[model samples]
Target: MSIWWSLHLRREAASVPLARRLLLGTMESAGVDPDISYDLSVALSEACANAVEHGGDGALDGAAEAYRVTAYLDGETCRIEVADSGPGFGAAGGDAGRLSAEAENGRGLYLIQELADHVHFGTEPGLGGAVVSFDKILKWRKGASPLLAV
Candidate 1:
């Protein structure tokens, strides 16, 4: 089948719920299983929240920076992309996967990588801004099985 679904909106934490609903609903309507749906929602929420909190002003104003979220589903594989119109981080260092039990933050990248089958962070096309994408592998079932699965 095809593999593309997208939604773009201005940066605001309040809009995160909207993005989550849209992304999760798209996967559900595309026939993704329930378990995959839950994972998608959780991962997307984290990505969108990071974008709103770090990329934009987290305001309701229309002039605020923009956040674009795109989701692609093909067979049992789902890919999600979250991009923002803001400056890119120079160098992503530090232990993203710290074992500390008292850390307040710095786990966004770690969680994304841990949960997703595949995760990537980079500058958007044409260097527009930052783009974070992750891929989810759904459980195979019935007639949805492909010749060779992931």
Candidate 2:
């Protein structure tokens, strides 16, 4: 069950579902349990949504025009990352501000923290942007792929 893919997509709201759909398709084909797949997909969407919102709005024609997403599934675990081209953490809507306002509204970052088993919130090295990464131990359906059974 070694599978991985990456995408460079424009910083747009629609890119969120496009990325999620791809992940879902991959998981479905791999015979992953639907519940687990849904959890990961939700986390992935939050990460991407954050990127689109805080990944900077300038430079539409330049390298900053898009964000990056990468997912890797190996053995019994799956890891995913979403990186933006804007300012990194602490500056993303201000960490303190977001935390304080958490009770009043839904924060994508917070939702991601709740969904994924292992999560990392950090800056993209040298790129000067936020990178949200997470991993979860995978479970398979009753008749999962032979590769995953081992």
Candidate 3:
């Protein structure tokens, strides 16, 4: 079975946990394993935090204060994408894998890469924003089939 959802949220710190909770609820209800669910929730938080912090035009007003998040669950795999209207990673030119440990910031992408089974960066659909997408292969806790919930 396949399930998906998308959320267009304000670029606020509070919105981060809202997205995480929703993802956790969805996965738990579908019988996803606890460990996989925890990892994905943490990874999703990092991705959402990145979008909230960097995905907007440097302006503090208007439409620049929003980001989009999408998630898909298909059988044993779950994919997630977070996109923002700010300048993309390409413009910043920092490698996600090479961040310094002592830096006060810049670890979101690295965390996502570490948690997700696959990761990709690109432009948001039709918005020219930075998009960080990742996916993980899920393991059911007791041979449960998520398709049944579909």
Q: Pick the candidate with the highest TM-score.
A: 2
lDDT of 2 by residue, 32-105 (tens): 88999999999999889888887984765665768999999888998999988787775443462354234654
Clashing pairs in 1: none
Per-residue accuracy of model 3 over 28-141 as CA lDDT, tens digit each: 888899899999999999989988888788775666799989999987799999988887766445465465545567677777887899988777656677888899998876
Q: What TM-score does each of the candidates earn?
A: 0.76, 0.87, 0.86
Report how far residue 53 has shifted in candidate 2, in Å.
0.8
- Tens-place lDDT per residue, model 1, 1-115, is 7557677776767888998888666655566666777887888888888788767543465434778888877766788998876554434623442523356874776677767
Model 1: CA > 4 A from native: 57-64, 91-103, 140-150
Please list the C-alpha lDDT of all candidates, in the order they appear: 0.70, 0.83, 0.84
2 or 3, greater by TM-score:
2
User: In model 3, which regions exceed 4 Å deviation?
Assistant: 59-61, 91-93, 97-104, 143-145, 148-150
Q: How many times do residue backbones clash in model 3?
A: 1
TM-score sort, best first = 2, 3, 1
